[model samples]
Target: MYRFLITTSKGLEQLLQQEIQHLLPEIETRNRPGQVVFEAELADAYRLCLWSRLANRVLLQLRSGKGETGDELYDLANKVNWSSHFSADQSFSIDFVGTSRAINNTQFGAMKIKDAIVDHFKDLFDTRPNVEKQFPDLKFHGRLNKEGFGIYLDLSGGSLHQRRYRERAGRAPIKENLAFAVLMRSGWVDAIRNGDESSAEIPVFDPMCGSGTILIEAAQYAAKIAPGLHRHQWGFSHWKGHDIPLWFSLLDEAKVGQITPSMRFLGTDIDAHVIEIAKDNANIADVGDFIQFEVADATQQPNTFEKAGYIVSNVPYGERLGELTELLPMFKSWGGHLKQAFPEWHLSLLTSDRDMLRQLRLMAGKEYQFINGNIECQLVNFHLDEKNCHIADKEQDNHSDFANRLRKNISKLKKWLKTANTDCYRVYDADLPEYNVAIDVYGDWVVVQEYAAPKNIPKHKTISRLQDILIAIPDIMQIEPSQLVLKTRQVQKGKAQYQKLDKSSDELIVHENGAKFAVNLHDYLDTGLFLDHRDVRQKVRQMSKDKRVLNLFAYTGSVSVFAALGGAKSVTTVDMSNTYLNWAKRNLALNGIKGAYQYPLVRKDCLTWIRECEQQFDLIFVDPPSFSNSKNMQGSWDVQRDHAGFLRLVRMRLAPGGTIIFSNNLRQFKLDPDLQDSLGLRITDISAESIPFDFKRNQKIHHCWVMQDDA
Candidate 1:
């Protein structure tokens, strides 16, 4: 029997060992973090490489010895006859790992091994083999660590994970072997063949299937198809010691072993473009007829199968705070849908965030830890029985506490709302420390903003609190679930503030102090109208009667819409993004205001446009972002660093004695004294005046100033 070593991912060593034991039962095996060593015959090695799904590489042991210096490593490598493995015409490459005291550089250690092989061949046959780094005929692997040195011939050409079927992959695609491990740990194979003939046809579904990796793997497993059979070449195919006839016989057996099983594999994704890519990959794997692809959202998965089977998915892990905010509510809604529609189906979710998994409220039966490309992750298996489907009273207690806080805050803000004659306002802003979310009212609609949780708090606990908040908002606010909008509040910098979180084009007309504007609660992190700027928009209306007005850095042009309605002689709105420019025009048309030159919307960088403008305005609204590095802009913009220069440009076009209303949401802002001295302008702080009564608790939400040239 010959000794062979198999390598896999760090946490999958045990599973690989079990797989090997099943294929070759009499083989002696030893396993570690990423490698499994075993004693088997050459035929068994060939069989293992052909059928093993969880292995990354298979290497045949050639030599092992202790070596501290480069010369000693060369001596260990030279002990093997160099000409037996491959001829002088064949090309080869060396892959070196680990470092020792003497072999500080891996490249230097590899060079020593190469020299020894070439010298041995040159002295014997008067010629040496060529070294091809990209696609070599023979690949050598060397390891040098604290234990000692090992030299082996890689029997598996490249990484076995490259199944050669996926011509392309989607963003953050999980490796094929990793997907196999998930299926094994989740009992997918056992569930399909549980002695009941009816179970053999149980359906498998992946809602967030990206490039259909899991679906292809499941189809292959159910149909009894070997993964390596799709590849055209392998490391052993060109080796001199390879038994060509024996390999073909095994290949023919694997091909004949593939059976047409009665299994339904379905995959769905939100992106239609990616669904086509997944279909192409499935066809290449020869499982196209077994699997079906469609475009569907995870929150509202289609119940296509009559009987309950399995729902396995690699859900999104929000690496950014904004993404976390968006995914939390989606997970909660998906959980509710599964409990209602597919009560008997089991779920196996893989994600980096355990809290996200807990949002489903289903008790996980078993959990396995894995490392997916440096990110630690968990695969949680849930048997969705009646016992786990219902929410326990203890979970309801958290929701009750949040509702009580919301009710008390609404009672306190009720009188102020009536006095101001407003239907939209803020009801809750972290009144209780444990429930950290901001609640706002837009008539019958409510928008909830979750503040970023502290790093020290356990992520699962934070997610639990968010789920509780979502459950309480509709009940306490006496509104339907569709009216509640949830978002995560983060300190956005650069163009991230304008990034679209969703593609819903739904818009609503909301009133603020007798002026009507459009508000889209679903499409963006911030609603089209800033509720804190309610009083500021009113101020713009009061100051813009029949005056030539210019709105700079106008986002969505809510203030510009107000200025036009207030009888401004001319309104010039300037912004960079065409999306916002078109939105501003729609807002204008919605209010029955229309004109070409009378109310023109310019799609240009406000900072650059201001320098080129010669026309004067009686009133200018300047609300620049706190920080912006948009690629369309000339240079980076920081409100604090570039405010003085930006204001100087605005002053040149300010019809003499024109008023500039400068506002931003930077909480810790202090106007530069040098700017005030250089421009000879009189400045008044109207930050307190701009805030509506609902925003009294957080007075520093925005900073506003009235600047006038005192020349």
Candidate 2:
């Protein structure tokens, strides 16, 4: 028997534990910061190494040893019975994780330990052991924790989480462990595993199953498919103490348990090509014989399953999905379909968009807050019935969010609106004046007036001031310009800029730098104009000439205009929204620019559009929405989750000498550091000077980066 520890991202620890627990009837799983430790015999370890979706690495316990420093650790490790683990002809490697007072240097400790093992062998058998860093027969694991030290042998070659089925990358795919948690929470897989695979007790359906991970998992579990049957190698096989006969017998036993289920799992995705990938993945996992995969829109009919079953969904939630207006209907439509078609089914929806969650008609039965990698998300469980259980006419949500300042200060503004002879408006007035902000929704314009005292004024001089409080309340918070009801807003204040073209425009400003060329401005109130990135634009402009440039989300084509103005031979501009695409065209015409915009006027969602294309530019520009949910783009696509996919998609299109400028306004912009090595992409943070002068609220409005492929 092998004792195995599977490591996962710190965030998915609970989820991984649940997955392990669900896998075996008496499975003992323990979790630490970034790992899940389990009691696995030789077979269990081998099975885990092959099948764990959540476990990052599976480590088998070796001889436990302790030490203070490198020398001490080496001396301790040297005392281990190596002859029983490996022969003199075999090679080995040592990996170390450090924390603690005694050993601060991991490499130093590993080298010392490696030396000790070799020297120990030399002392016993008159020959030193070989050091194989890349692929060693036996891998040793050592960790120097704050309190004490521990040692183990890495049984999993790559990592337990590496399902080995995904061909390359699927867009914003759910992590394996989280998928398991979602499945377990829904109770579908449990029913099947508990003796109901043939009954259709609750047909498990993943409507937005991109690559069919959950579906695959359910099929494997129902079929009694041991997760560890597909691996090429495991660390235990090389260990001297490994029970090879026991492992072989266990594999044969588990293999014999495979069921050619009549019809147990179903996975559907909207994108046809993606569905094909999911099918390919099922085949790779050897579950193709038992699982079914297909292409179907979760939001549309005919594709929707009417059978009372469990539905697990993860829809689009960000810019790639469209905007809030688009996302709202998607939620409503999905809710309507589920309620109408599957009354007996329960649903577990995983998403990060709070706005979308608020739109769901189903009363949330329970919710589990978990992370999908870096993003915080909610796993909302919906107990489905034919209708809302305690159903009543849902009132239009006229009440301000309590979290909204408007609610806190509603009474004060109520008084002011009456005195000021203002009717039909959102009034929020309070003595805690700092929190006071009043807003009136006039047809086309929303008049948001603020009240704050001026610093000081002489008694003789007339002084009046209206501080900007409604600044946080954007005019287009919930609707589009077409949807905008533009009743006139009558505010008793300074004259308006004659409705200063509130929408993004065609005019763009240019900033030039020597190394590359980029736009100083776009049509967006944000070129398509983020004034915060003035310095970055200056860098792009300077670097523009003779550089092939590509700009994504190229609103009003500002970057393209700038690159052209900077004398680049060609510039490509891609945007998903037609309004923005045409705006780019208009900006180009306004700037007297041409080239690159001729063919690739990508109207499809940027993420999807980029995924299908293969064209490279010397310098590529990527600036997408910080947060948006538009249905036209198919689904929500958060930049953070979508960033790597976007980078991968766009980098493949970049020329050998090209570079990509990735920018987003997300305040807590987290550029995945792993992207550098994982995607062969290098990003340099250029957020410091991206802000422009005119719109200077902060020195940094967004984080910008210059991404380059390895030369």
lDDT on C-alpha atoms for all candidate structures: 0.85, 0.62
TM-score of 2: 0.57
TM-score of each: 0.72, 0.57
Per-residue error for 656 in candidate 1, Å, reads 8.9
Model 1 residue 488 distance off true place after TM-score fit, in angstroms: 3.9
Error of 2 at 642 (Å): 43
> How close to the true structure is residue 388 of candidate 2, measured as C-alpha lDDT?
60
lDDT of 2 by residue, 321-410 (tens): 114334555565576676666666788888886446545566788887777878788888887664563343233233334225444444
Which residues of candidate 2, in runs, are more than 4 Å off?
1-44, 47-54, 65-68, 125-127, 195-201, 262-264, 302-306, 319-325, 386-525, 528-711
The digit string of per-residue lDDT tens for model 1 on 343-439 reads: 8788998998888776687788999998888889999999878987785434463346677777777888878777675677898888678888888
How displaced is residue 33 in candidate 2, in Å?
4.7
Best prediction by lDDT: 1
